[model samples]
Target chain A: MKPWWIVVRKEVLESLRDRRTLLSALVMAPLFGPLMFSFSMQTMLKRGLDEQDKPLQVAVMGKEHAPNLVHWLESQGLEDVPAPKDVASIPAAVRDAKPRLVLVIGPDYGKRFRAAKAAGVKVYVDSSDQDSQRDFRRLDQLLQNYSSQTSALRLAARGVDPGIAQPVMLDEIDVSTPASRAQSLLAILSYFLLFSTLIGGMYVAIDATAGERERGSLEPLVSLPVSREALVAGKFVATMAFSGVSLVLTLASFAISLRFVPLESIGMSANLGPKVLTGVFLSLLPFVPLAAALLTLVASFARSFREAQSWMTGALLVPTLPIMVAAMTGMKPTALLMAVPSLSQHFLIARLLRDEAVPLTDGLLSAGGSLLLTGVLLVFVVRLWRREKLLG
Target chain B: MIHVTGLAKRFGTVEAVRDVSFTAPDGRITGLLGPNGAGKSTTLRLLYGALTPDRGEARVDGLLAGPEHTEARRQLGVLPHGAGLYPHLTARENIRYFGELHGMSGATLEKRIDELVAMLELGEAANRKTQGFSQGQKVKVGIARALVHSPRNLILDEPTNGLDVMAIRSLREVLRGLRAAGHCILFSSHVMQEVAALCDDVVIIAGGRVIASGTPEQLREQAGTTTLEDAFVKLLGSETAEVQS
Candidate 1:
């Protein structure tokens, strides 16, 4: 047999024969991406729809100051949650967590709006938690709508047309088509894709290295006609094959899930259009090989089955840092920025989400650079294989 | 078949094998006798190319041993201290695995495996995984795997270190037969009787260097001793001489 062919055949056969390792390699990889995406998107989507539909659940602490404000909030589907007897008693209710939000009225009452000196309503919110922040935001929006409508009516009551009193108004007509939302949704998908590529071949890589050592069969293999570089290369190629399969399956799963999803329910007219999917997928292609090679090199150094697995899982989760940054606040993409691991892909996904044009050069650089790094990693693994201290 | 010259190996600051030199000629059983940590295994590893020496060389059939000298390795067989067979694979599979690595294939591999199974008397345990095999069975399998490839030079490191008395005897018989078959056999051991009974030539190592080398009787006569153990102690100059030096 050709020397590398011997290695490749042995690796593929052994990985398949070992039921646990085979299943872990074949199953967990494809399972993780779809399961994670479906559950996460489902949760976020459900929570979003629920929030818009949930009767705002406004808690009015100072109802006596302006009865009109309370009535206005009711019209917006906000139900007031009665508070403790007095404003001094409000702190205990917040401490006991009886209410998500606490809106206290100042002693000025209706007189402040008449004077316009202190038209401010005190909003005491629990910013310490997720539910609190979300609840506070909805309440804040409800109060703004009330205040703006009240100001307009107040002007009209004074014989001044509200349009005349206000010379200008802020208008934000988002040009982001339905295709854009679909593209932004791809941000999380990019993370999933990136994570899938790095972790998919984890089992195969670990099996090819630590499994061979643990079986006490590595030294003999090392003492073969083949060079250590060839052995590492063969194993690397097998691992990359496993990773590529996962990337493809994950992308396919996303395509299927997005097609059936009701985007309009969330008030997004986004069509996970073919163009956006193609853009995001094309941008991620170069990373797949690099990620597989990098993880394979890392897995090759692990001393045991458990160590290899842990290293693989760690590689997948580490990308979450960049994913979170872009998902939380998508800063503008720059030339140097595309050089970052997931930055360019993320911005690309975001632009496609917002239905904006992306420079073709960014996608090429991201994939090409990733492929180059993979090559360097392959060289490093070859050298490591020659070192005796790492056999385990 | 094996040659060694100044085969010194060191780990960091400590010298594991220092200025060690010897040859186990073809068709002979050469005994390597040493106390614990006396660089016996280190020397064997250097000989088999498992480790690189800080200085000197180990040549099998005129080819130098090192990480890249795999082609040179096909001529040798090794039973590393405990038989480096995978516990998860059956004894048969382990032997076949190593055989394949040594370039045995197809009919040659199957026929050789059968011959080893019969020779090692592992018919019952051959198909059963080595994970729960008794130490004696493991030793037997280790021996079978080392000799199965029909390597001209056989290097065993403390082959009977932990084998039971019966297992030791069985292994001795196998070694005696191999010696008679004219395979160049070099093995290390601390047991003097094993060396006295099995080796035609014995080399005594102390503090990473050879202290005495000769036939067991020659060394015993040179030290005015009746037994190989006594000859080893006298020629190596016991603890007192070591302390004075």
Candidate 2:
């Protein structure tokens, strides 16, 4: 037992001493979520709010016909960026972000409006840019509104029933919690966090132990006066340390991002404060040890680092089963569902982001069960220490 | 210090180490000589409690080779094949880290580290990360790590696996000095000259069985040959001897 403690202490020291693993565990992954999430979420939210119903910038090209059409769009709030008359200039202007909408008025455009005809105007648009699309759609709606408003006025001028010009109007309302709104986008991010904790740490864990054996270092380790049980614990803790750090970082990232993402822009009022973020971090805690244990089992039998990496990767990918299922059909955060490995973290995190209190039972059950599984793994690893092939 | 009786290990259908037996006296250098797959490494693993035999028993200071076995291992030190140093750690850090694993603390661990560094002539490289060191330097660091905890028994597996002549000579000198100080030393090797020069007793194994084990002179006498190499060939069979299977 004493000697095994030495092995465990050594595992930690070596891990800390290794610049690559240290950087990945303590610095890289932890900051990854905060950095990427905050940047993306803030940008998206700002764009969604600031750019809503924005005016389209149209470039005029070829044949000045309907001065009324140009006057109609200016009234709709479009400020045009002057464009060259060449047809090729349409693509070039859109590419340079000079104009989002390029309208080529034909020589017969005045004849078309006077005839009250559905004569077409060639309009080229940049379809790929979401902002450009929003502006384009608004411009389309404004044009249609202008034509309708003119028709109604014309009918009124004829002394028809003004009341009969329009009988109906349409408005829309969205009723969803701030958490649910955030969950809509963050569910994808959650899947990635789950993978890093489970799959990424699985690689680190298996490689630490099984890699040593395949390299034939296990014999020296065994030949020392280290207890088998302590050796298992040492390896287990080292792996879980890597996982725990990642879990904390991933949750902290979401928590910080949500709190600071300015959800009011999207009409969401949810706040990811100390309590909520803490709950989220707590929710992910159980998965850390469970993931480590599963990977440890796979690594113990692996013949080399590559073999362990592949096998543990396959094993860690087991989380994706629940991820795929959750993605296919949303899961309700039930006590039973939340207690199951892989799925539970994602399911509960989705709820947590929606500002739903993670049920105490779910957190306890998941943490308790994972810790129990860790015990089972520790037992197995200890037994593995006595195996000749693995030890030597 | 270590006893083996009819030990055997089977991996599914293939038996890696078969029924074999030997005794290692305390305060003596015991050489385990065999071909690459002849189970010499396996035998060493049994003594370290790394492997559990499917049959018979291997005991170190009366401790059976089993899962969780550690009582006898406390007085044991090991320098595995290739040194097994984590490449990222400095030499001083590596020694302190393993020493801590053996429960050496604060002042004691520091003192031990200093002594090992000084003894191994590694003052200059002690602070350098192992990644940049030459093979001989790494091997010396490995020896320092094994001796850090001051175990009564030391096991070196292919201690000279890849070394220049100077490094090998240095290693031989270290082993000889440790032997002189009454430390139980066990090493596995395929080199005849190394074992003949450093070992006080030799155990020659072939086909997973111990064919001859005695003092070098005794083994030579048993084979009616003057040289240890000649005696090994006679006992383990001719170098040109062919196996049908």
Candidate 3:
């Protein structure tokens, strides 16, 4: 066997024996991402389902002025309640989580309806509240229906055709598939997947580099006949191997856990078939080497394992940038984006999940870019090792 | 043989080693005797290719020793200061790791490990992990790892700094046996009795410079003292006196 492979085997074997490294890097890191995703999805879905089953309560201030509207709301599964004494009290009630929807009907509502004029109905809701926001939309749709029905009755009383009031009939056709809509709502999926690939090898990389230096064995090992380049290559390969296993475990965990999420109830479909899983795995594979090399290079500068861990934690923010920016800007994946590293992999995973046909050229471009970066990073680490202060 | 000629190294503005030169010939044990901060560690580091010299060279068997000189490094085994064994690995595994790096593997590496384990009297500790090992046990493991590849030359920095008296006596015996086997061994120490007892030739260094080099008896005669320790003190005292003059 080559000297480098020997070094790699020793490092991997040593890390595997360390219970701390194995627990965090292999078992916990992979499981955390998928578990976090499923937990969050399940919570949000549960909230939405609960909101659907619960009755909506509308607080009306001038209930006497709009008996018909109140009656109409009651027929649509909305309960009527007397509003608080003052409009300002409505915000306090909402803050206390008392009522999510409130309706304010002025005394002039009766006069306006008798005179056939537009009457103002003020709806007070905490738009910041997610549940209140859903209920408010439902209440708004009900009021619109009541207005049209009342207008038609007035027209009938005047012996005029009710169709004269409606000049145009409009309908909306949504062409988006459940998977495509799910892609945006579940943007977190790609983030967690990429994060898993980046973090899975972190403990191994630090253990091989900074941990070796701390143990005082690095100088003896370096004094051997093997070249520094081979030493670095061996360590890098080990880290990448650990990361690949972590990625596989993470994807598998997500695949199994996602089945129980009830995504169809929310108009989102995520199919973790063998094909999609394979595609996501392949798309993330090219970046594993780059992540390992970059992490190892940065960690090599640290004087101790704890110091290296802190720097690695700070470095993790870099990978999260692409996803954060994409979310903030609602970035559409362009051809140029397909050539970027983390963004490209994220884009590919999303596309595969959405059932979009990702071209072979896109995959090749991303892979080539990642490999090129890995080569550069590996050379940089080798050079850093050659420096005298690295022993310190 | 190991030759370090006109070797000089500087750390920032401080001259850590200046004009250090010595030779440890085959079939002999050479001692580098000096007090703390006397550049003994720096000189050994240069000899083992752990540091580059700012001036001159270190030659192992006529080949220049430096980072890129793998051939010379293959001919040398180094146990640097405070060298540590992997606590998680057995003593045998630690020795085999270095052997593999030197391209010795399979049955040959195993045989070498067994021989070194017996020579160091580490039979009981050979199969166990090195964690929580005593100072003597740790040194035994380090020595085994250094000699795993059977290099022509060996450089050890303070091999007996923290060892017990019994451990030191056993280690001295091992060095004597290696000398009889025609291995060139160079080690650094400040203990007068240890140097007087084991070294065939001694190089005394102070302030990063080699002030004197000779057999222990010769050094005693040069200082007109019967004891090697007094002789070494007198030699250092004269050097300072001459610098003042």
Q: Which one is best on DockQ?
A: 3
- Candidate lDDT values, in order: 0.76, 0.75, 0.87
For candidate 1, the docking band is acceptable
Work out candidate 2's RMSD over C-alphas.
5.1
Q: On residues A211-241, what C-alpha lDDT tens digit does candidate 2 reach at each position?
A: 7776555656666655666677778777877
lDDT of 2 by residue, B1-245 (tens): 77789989877887878878988778899999987898887777666666667888887667776545777677678787788777767899878877877778899889999998987889789999888888899889989989998877788888888899988988888888888888888899999999998899999888777878899999999989989999988877753364433
Tell me what TM-score chain B of candidate 2 gets against the true chain B.
Answer: 0.94
Off by over 4 Å in 3: A81-88, A144-170, B237-245
Model 2 interface CAPRI class? acceptable
Q: What DockQ does each prediction reach against the true complex?
A: 0.36, 0.47, 0.77
The digit string of per-residue lDDT tens for model 3 on A296-345 reads 89888898999999998887777778878887899887777777788888
Chain B TM-score in each of the candidates: 0.96, 0.94, 0.97
Q: Write the per-residue lDDT of candidate 1 for residues A304-381, one digit (tens) a residue.
A: 888777777777776577667755685567777676666666666667667677777887776666677778888888
lDDT of 3 by residue, B1-245 (tens): 99989999999998999888889999999999988998998888777777888998999999998888788899888887776788878888899999998899899999999999999999878999888788888888898899998988888889997999999999899889888999999999988888999999999999899999999989999999999999999999988888789
**Per-candidate iRMSD:** 2.9, 2.9, 0.9
Error of 1 at B222 (Å): 2.2
Each candidate's number of clashing pairs is: 6, 4, 0
Assess every candidate by TM-score: 0.88, 0.77, 0.94
